[model samples]
Target: MLSFLEGHTSEVCACAWSPAGSILASGSGDSMARIWTIADVMSRSSLQNEHSSVVVLKHVKGKTNEKNKDVTTLDWNKFCSAPPASYPSGMGCASCGHVKFKAGSARHGVFRVEGRLLATGSYDGQARIWSTNGKLKSILNKHKGPIFSLKWSKKGDYILTGSVYKTAIVWDVKAEEWKQQFEFHSGPILDVDWRNNVSFATSSSDNMIYVCKFGESHPIKTFSGHQKVVLLFLFSFSSGKKGDMWVSAKHYFVWAKLTVSNGTPTGSLLASCSDDITAKIWSMKQDKYVHDLREHAKEIYTIRWSPTGPGTNNPNKQLLLASASFDTTVKLWDVDQGRLICSLNGHRGPVYSVAFGPNGEYLVSGSLDKSMHIWSLKECKIVKTYPGSGGIFEVCWNKEGNKIAASFADNTVCVLDFRM
Candidate 1:
């Protein structure tokens, strides 16, 4: 919907929703990555608001009413390189203004924990880091093929990059080099997830998932049961809930991202979407489905568990699940009972992404319909609509739920400043 934010020259490839505060990152084939934030950069509503995030970085140390600062510094070239000479003096960060970097065809982009930094992978067989002000910080040019996926370590100390070369790399963000390199997949690596600050898992087109760690040359564990490429895998952690962490891998079953309850002491509750047009809640310990939610008529694409939980953020509240599907619908489920508490339908095409606000009071969805919807979960109604220039590939709420970011098929990313 936000057209004023335009810089890419080709179709956007991937987008990352900041687990931190109000920040967003998008990668495009135009060989560029863009970072976005709201105009009120100093707003700290995200603190103590994103469930129980342990990696959130502190705000910039300066104190002179940083609110109303432009989301990003001006005069930084679209290439994320040094500003051109024709620009007026003092147009950009004096120090980073002279840094040299040329953004390649971006394949993926993600923001680090505090929203102060970003990492983007490109078709140029490289990855680049940028500061929150959109200044280029570092460039990693090591992979052999276009990097397709990336995952930052929980503490923001490491970054894992997956590529089409049947290989993956773990880069030390501070040391600025490959901490370790891994190669075991028979085909291209499609997805990756960090299970802890030091270990992670990778799903490959070869139909396998590998558990690897830093400084290790071989996989510590491997899973091989999928009949087709394992296209999706997600790692989730909740410090407020027994300090538990888990990873889910999606296979030919038409995988869906799974979310764990924030802080349930008994056991972790996971919700998964499937191509069978159903949402199921499973017990991590029992390894069995506990409840089944059937309402959608088409394959479900995404699912997210509310950050609030039974014993944590909102002890008195029910744990909720949000599921989006190809049927152009988003459904909210009551986890304990597996009941379809509410069905939200407003998109004209397949719903590709759905996310719960940090407060668990709102939900946002994006779709091939070229629009984004912000729904009030408590009201079961679409409260707001944002127009778009192309079909949306993804939509996500920042940690505080104060900003929503959507990636477009038209090679652009739009960040909406949400007020509710």
Candidate 2:
């Protein structure tokens, strides 16, 4: 590790590398988010470091003794420019202006794809929008229960929030109002992801997934099969152009460009894992799953698709799916063949997170064993391992893939210089 960040007073639950990969953002149980500047340290020749700049973002109002003030999640916007002049009124707030947060902790934070605005959901049944520089922009106050997950559309025009009230709301970013509200989930919504700008999919504690569009009162499509609570969902595309893709709940969803003989687009595929110890791939054209991955002995915690294959940054590499499990192993899958390519068995504890480098040549996995391993995809072996002071909650590779930022249970964040 190049340096350790120690300002947070509690466990750091989440961390995200900025799109440019120069800045690192972390959310902690201390009711605060921190922006750490590490570009200078990364440029130095020496591996060891201590001094670095940090910006502390307080999420609570004036001093209080309330509990559960943690910042549960964090995300960085891809764009950094100011919003256009035609944006809705009352959407711009000063960077230093203080916005009061009620009696609950912030559960999730996501940035608009355009990169200028951030939206955060809290347990107080509200979602707040903020500028990139940490200004309060607007407050969304419609959900009656605590929010659990949220996401911004790819077009940067809308924000989707899922709440414990069993409802999901689509907020119009430009208009600063909710565009539509869907209340079809029978249980608390755990996670959500946008398949396109107009439609999205939601996973709930009811073991069901629903795909909803902007104006539709009912789900366009529903997926059910998991016998346990669905925790997270993601959409992966097959090509560079916008095309049909799949959505999965709890584990992950893989989307690929489906085309017909005439070159027109068809629907996409979806892959999902669950507490049931299996990850299944689904087809949009049919009701049955395409593949059922059942090698894990315990619950699968997370899944990530490699940024490779056709149309990605690493076009020459094969596209693969990675699943991290409580079974203390990370498995790489050949999504097209519906088979396991290799099993990463270096970590001694349950793997909590796995991330592929931007170049898609290496993969990083962090575990409860307090160790992070960097594996060479081609060799299917660990090339480097870094032991941490605490169990790691999350790990992410910067855009350049030369730096990695990890959040830990020890109330600290570590930035590892990968080039070393």
Candidate 3:
């Protein structure tokens, strides 16, 4: 731990790591959010505390606030992943300007992947964009209620936002206008995720999941088969499956379950988890279980593959799979070997999210026990931990793997500087 960040006069509500790991932005009950820089944290000379041996990470950026409303949540623009220009490939919004806008209450914030624009949603019933340096960009005023979720396209050309108004909107960034809006949800939309640049999936309080595409007035596919939110869906005959939670005759559809996902665009391979107490990777070639990832003694609830997989981001990338189980362990697997590489243990409760850093050098997991662990794949050990906080709802790494963000029950967000 660098010195404990102490500026949030209240429970921190939400935090997000920038697209690059240089900055960590956290929101709190104080109606404030602060951005901290990793370079500033690392460059400081070490000094011993008068009271204890633990090193404290100091906050370089002061508390950032708007309107004295509890900051709710935020996200990083994950779209600008173009390797590198003249500078480094992954430094995020910290390099932009610094300006804050007063709003009703911030519900979420996201940076453009190119690290040029930032968007924030507030209870004021608006979504806004700004320059990376915090200069005001534009205000997207359409949703009549608070915006809860936002996702930028991989191409960085479009933005998606879901709101409490039972609607989701897609905005065209280049034109500075909203191109399409979805209002079919019977209740407030709870979450929105992009399947690709052109298609997305939305889950609503109406107990439905809809697959929508750009410019479509109606959903291309609607899923009403689950009693609860389905985090991910997988299809494959190449890997393995055991539980009867779901079954499909051909391809394109399968049983959906809790956390764990990452799919190729062509649907050549699929990975998913279920109540069957197993982690299975199914493929198109065999249409059955190819490798049964087993080790956790309890139900495996979450799984995630390295974003830079064999066919996607990295051409020569090593295929890796990670799974979090009720057994209080996070296991890393060598997909090619069909073997469990190692298991990480430290959390005292069910793990909620398991994410692989974009570079595939580290893996992070958050749990109900209010702890976040960063494990080094090279060392196969728990490297650092941001101990003790409200139960974490989710954890994610920026594209460069330099920083991380976690959402908590305390209504706070914590961003930690990571070195892997």
Ranked by TM-score from best down, the candidates are: 2, 1, 3
lDDT of each structure? 0.59, 0.72, 0.57
- Preferred candidate (TM-score higher): 2 or 3: 2
Residues 147-243 of candidate 3: C-alpha lDDT, one tens digit per residue: 7667666656677888878999998866778989998888777566665678766656564656688878898765453333333433222222222
- Model with the higher lDDT, candidate 1 or 3: 1
Kindly list the per-residue Cα lDDT of model 1 for residues 1-420, writing each as its tens digit: 232345655565556664444445666554455655445432333322122211211112353223311111111112222234533332432322322223341321221123456676665566776775656677776888767677556556677888889988988777889988899998988766565567777777785667787778888766554454455544333223343323233311111222335333422333334445555543334434456667888776666666665444554455666777788998887654667888898889998887777787888898999889999888899999987768887776666666777777886666666785
TM-score computed on alpha carbons, candidate 3: 0.63
Better of 1 and 2 by TM-score: 2
* TM-scores, one per candidate: 0.67, 0.85, 0.63
Q: For model 1, what is the error of residue 93's alpha carbon versus the real structure, in angstroms, after optimal superposition? A: 17
lDDT of 2 by residue, 210-238 (tens): 88888788998887878787776666655
Error of 3 at 32 (Å): 3.5
Summed over model 2, clashes come to: 7
